[model samples]
Target: MLRDLSRPIETGMPTYPGDPDVTLAPDATHGADGYATSRFRTGTHAGTHVDAPRHTLPEGEAIDERDVGEFAFDARLVDLRPLEQREAIAPEALPDPGAIDDDVDLLLLRTGWASHWGSDRYRDHPYLTAATAERCRAADVGVGLDAFGPDPTPTARGDTESPASDGDEPDGTPAHDVLLGDSLPIVENLCGLDDLPTRFRLYAFPLRLRGGDGSPVRAAAEWDD
Candidate 1:
């Protein structure tokens, strides 16, 4: 069976604050004696999508440079729904690191955040901690989230409890640095992973936009007996 692990891209879909709002305005229709058509305008990260390394890294490669084949593979799911903190995803919350096979290409974190996807809960959602990032590095796996970003803070942190400046860094850098620096791609703002089998074949491909920082992806998974 195949399941869509992506959220519907519509005017109502939740997006990051200050990001462009998704709009669907009809430009032509049969009633107007024209072919059916609609116009779309939104940020590249609007709905369920991937964040190319270039999105966070200063000199990282874009999506086009990353092979499309890299996006399809078998992955294991780790449910992090029990966590309530907005800070880093603690190492203890993770499953047996050895349980994840070195051959598995992606690690999908199944946090039931999609239920609050459109409300205030969506903002400041829990995310992967720096330590967790290091663990992923040792495990050699990419990470995917059902939330907006991998970090709980919009900016970098100073101490464990507070942001550099009033608990807010001028520009977010730690979380992005953790992955992009390691050449491990990240997929964020996904949905429906909570409804699929924990271990399945996942195929998520983005548009072939040459040198594009990021592109929307149609993420899905296949399961069988």
Candidate 2:
């Protein structure tokens, strides 16, 4: 069985704070031209995308520098739901490092935040604390999530329908410092993880952009039917 875990890139889609907004404009059409083509413009991290270590570290590897095989992984998903909006995910929320299967190279956390896509609540999704992130690295697995990023995407005052819960201050470079600083890739803005089997092979291939700090990806999952 195969399941697409990527979020669609469309004009005017919601993007990370301060990131470029997406736009799809037509450059040619079947009616006017002999072919149909459009000009696509958006930030590399616009939708479902991969963050190469270069996203944070100046000397880190670019997305194209990594081996393509790294895009595919023996993945495991953990459902951490019933979490409050903008809540801090505790380290205990994840499985103990020893319990992780030996074959698992990627760990995905499903917070059900994707359901709030296109809403103000989307920016207020739960985040993984730095401790939780360190734990994942200790487990020796890359991480993915259904929310924005592992760290709290700070909600600007009056930016959402409701205020962020108290103590929602952003943790500077929390997850990224631990995960990406260790040269591990991060897959963000994933959707449909809830439907995937507990164990599946995840593929999140990005465009082969030269020296790209990141690139949008078509993330998918596969397992026995």
Candidate 3:
């Protein structure tokens, strides 16, 4: 059986703050051009997308440069549901390393955040802590999440303080740094994880956009009955 783990991308769908809004404008219609087509525009990191190493590291590999074999893997789904809004999913939340299959190449975290897909609350969803990212890195597996990104808390949007003044980086994306620093790929905004088994085959191929930092993916899982 096959289950789609991608979130539906539609016009006016909720997007990360400051990211471009999705727009689908008709370019050709059956009544006008004898065909049906539309112009689709969205950010590369839009819903159900994969982030390549270049997403965070300046000298890292781009999505198109990655080997196709990396996109398909044996995945283990870890459920961390019933968490409060803006909660930090620490390393303790993950399953024991011994419990994970030796051959598993991917870890998909299900936080049940998809329930608030189109709401403002979606922006306040929980995120993985830096320690959890390090754990995944140590396991040498790709990671996927049901939230916007891996930061446990939102970055200060309009804060004018600089790192020199605040004694901290204006935007601290530690999760991305640790994972992407090692060239690990991350898939964000996954959905329908509740329908998947603990172990399944994940096929999430990103677009071969040259020099692309990330690309939207049609992520899915296959289970054998």
Number of the predicted model whose lDDT against the real structure is largest: 2
Instruction: Output the lDDT of residue 156, model 3.
Output: 42
Which tens-of-lDDT digit does each residue in 62-160 have in candidate 2?
999999999998999999988888888989999999999889988889999999998888988888888888889998888899888988786766664
Query: Per-residue lDDT of 1-225 in model 3, one digit per residue for the tens?
Result: 988989888899777777898998899999998999999999998899999889888899999999998899799988888897777788889876666778997888888888888766676677666888888888887788888978743434553331122222225788888999988778889988876888999889999999999999999899898
lDDT of each: 0.75, 0.88, 0.82
Flag regions of model 3 displaced more than 4 Å.
Answer: 153-171
Ranking by lDDT: 2, 3, 1
Between candidates 2 and 3, the one scoring higher on lDDT is 2
Show where candidate 2 strays beyond 4 Å.
Answer: none
Once fitted onto the true fold, the runs of candidate 1 whose alpha carbons sit more than 4 angstroms away are: 153-171
lDDT at position 108, candidate 2? 88
Instruction: State how far residue 104 of model 1 sits from its true place (Å).
Output: 0.9
Query: For residues 1-75, what per-residue lDDT tens digits would candidate 1 score against the true structure?
Result: 888878788986777766788988888898886578899987888788887888878698888998878888678
Model 1 poorest 10 in a row by lDDT: 155-164
Question: Cα RMSDs of all predictions?
Answer: 4.3, 1.3, 4.2
